[model samples]
Target chain A: MGRVVVDVMPKPEILDPQGKAVAGSLPRLGFGQFVGVRQGKRFELEVEGDVTQEHLDAAREAGVQVLSNPVIEDVVAVYADTAAVQA
Target chain B: MGRVVVDVMPKPEILDPQGKAVAGSLPRLGFGQFVGVRQGKRFELEVEGDVTQEHLDAAREAGVQVLSNPVIEDVVAVYADTAAVQA
Candidate 1:
């Protein structure tokens, strides 16, 4: 089986309250090194056979058209997860 | 600046309704090649200086103790985003 990885993140201009909350609590939790945090989505899409360029293209299309909302989010990455393929 | 990336995913035995919903919609949207979908979270923790071993260790602790629920989610990865560091 082959698996594709897709990452989606909120646009830089958009507000991310979840990220803000995490950042705010980090210092108090004794992890003061972190200055900012952004929470996003990661997706693993499994396919039956070896991954091909065609499958990657389809995943990219899905990443943008279905997985992410263009209004407030960006499809940051759409790539094959080689480790998953080997596994 | 540097960013530590954390990836958390629902345990294999756990139910993932969001992933199921996405999988169900793929074929209807013409991306039928996908056989399964797993949804997860990705977090970018920005720090003030270059990423070091200590910072990575701290991020790993936070990833397990704060970013994920041990009962339902697994902290799959804790690494630096090289591209983010260069940027």
Candidate 2:
């Protein structure tokens, strides 16, 4: 099986009130020196085949289309294990 | 100023109860074909310097040390814009 990791984050120019709220709460959470924090989504998928660059690309496209908003967010893809490809 | 985006997610083998809850709620939220979803943290930092690879690396290190559990999660760093470095 293959694993895909996607990260979704708000666009830089846009205001992220949620992020600001989190940043504000950090000190209360005992986290210091963390000037700011933005909240995003991560996804893990277990596909039925070996992990390949093509599979990664297709999964990423699907993620952007269905799970993320392109206008105010960005998605990134990461492979869990490259061994499947090498094997 | 340069912007850094960090994405943190739970490791694959670990159980992501929060992610499962989010995934379970997606259909009710009117999102379909999204078999699963995981939650994570994204960080955007406006560092007071050109965003060199060194800067990115340093920020990533700091993030891992403070915000993430290395045993159960992973972090990624992305550049917002490369124009400043080219100029």
Candidate 3:
């Protein structure tokens, strides 16, 4: 089976209150070097077969249309192996 | 400045209701090949200086301690550039 991953992030121009809330806590946690933090959502989908062009497209389209808010968020989708990714 | 990304996901063995909810919807969206879905959280942190080993350690530690639920979730931290990642 193949896998699809969608990452949804708030647009750079928008204010991220969740991120700000977390950022405000970094210093107390002994990580003041971190100047800011933005929170986002991740979706992982496991498909029943091999990865394909249509799968990739559908993953991206679903990421944009279903998982994220286009007015204030940016969506990106990953298909297949994410070994190179730390996650 | 360096960047830190923390990805938080439920342990594979655990049941993910949010994922199930979304997976339940893919078919109507014309992506039935995806048989399952898992929802997770992503934290993007913007640091104030150059990347370093200490920075990475802090990022990972923070990810584990602050961004994820230790009992049922898994956390992975990415340091610096995530160009290889779809995000």
What lDDT tens digits, residue by residue, belong to model 1 across residues A1-87? 999999999998899999999999999999999999999999999999888999999998999999999999999888888775533
Per residue, candidate 2 scores C-alpha lDDT tens digits across A1-87 of 555666667766668987787567655655444466666676665545655676566557655775578998877445554334211
Candidate 2: CAPRI quality band:
acceptable
Which portions of model 3 show Cα errors greater than 4 Å?
A83-87, B82-87
The true-versus-predicted C-alpha distance at residue B18 of model 1, in Å, is: 0.4
Relative to the true structure, how large is the alpha-carbon lDDT of every model?
Answer: 0.92, 0.62, 0.79
Interface root-mean-square deviation for each candidate?
Answer: 0.5, 4.2, 0.8
Q: What is the TM-score of chain A in candidate 2?
A: 0.80
Best by lDDT: 1
Best by DockQ: 1
Scanning candidate 2 chain B in windows of ten residues, the lowest lDDT window is B78-87
lDDT of 3 by residue, B1-87 (tens): 566777889888889999999999988988777788899998888876666777778888888888788999998436564444322
Per-residue lDDT of model 2, residues B1-87, tens digit only: 565666677776678887787677656655444455566676665555555676566567656775579999877445454434211
**Residue by residue across B38-71, what tens digits does model 1's lDDT show?**
9999999999888898899999999988999999
The DockQ-derived docking category for candidate 3 is: medium
lDDT-wise, the better of 1 and 3 is 1
Candidate 2 residue-wise lDDT at A49:
62
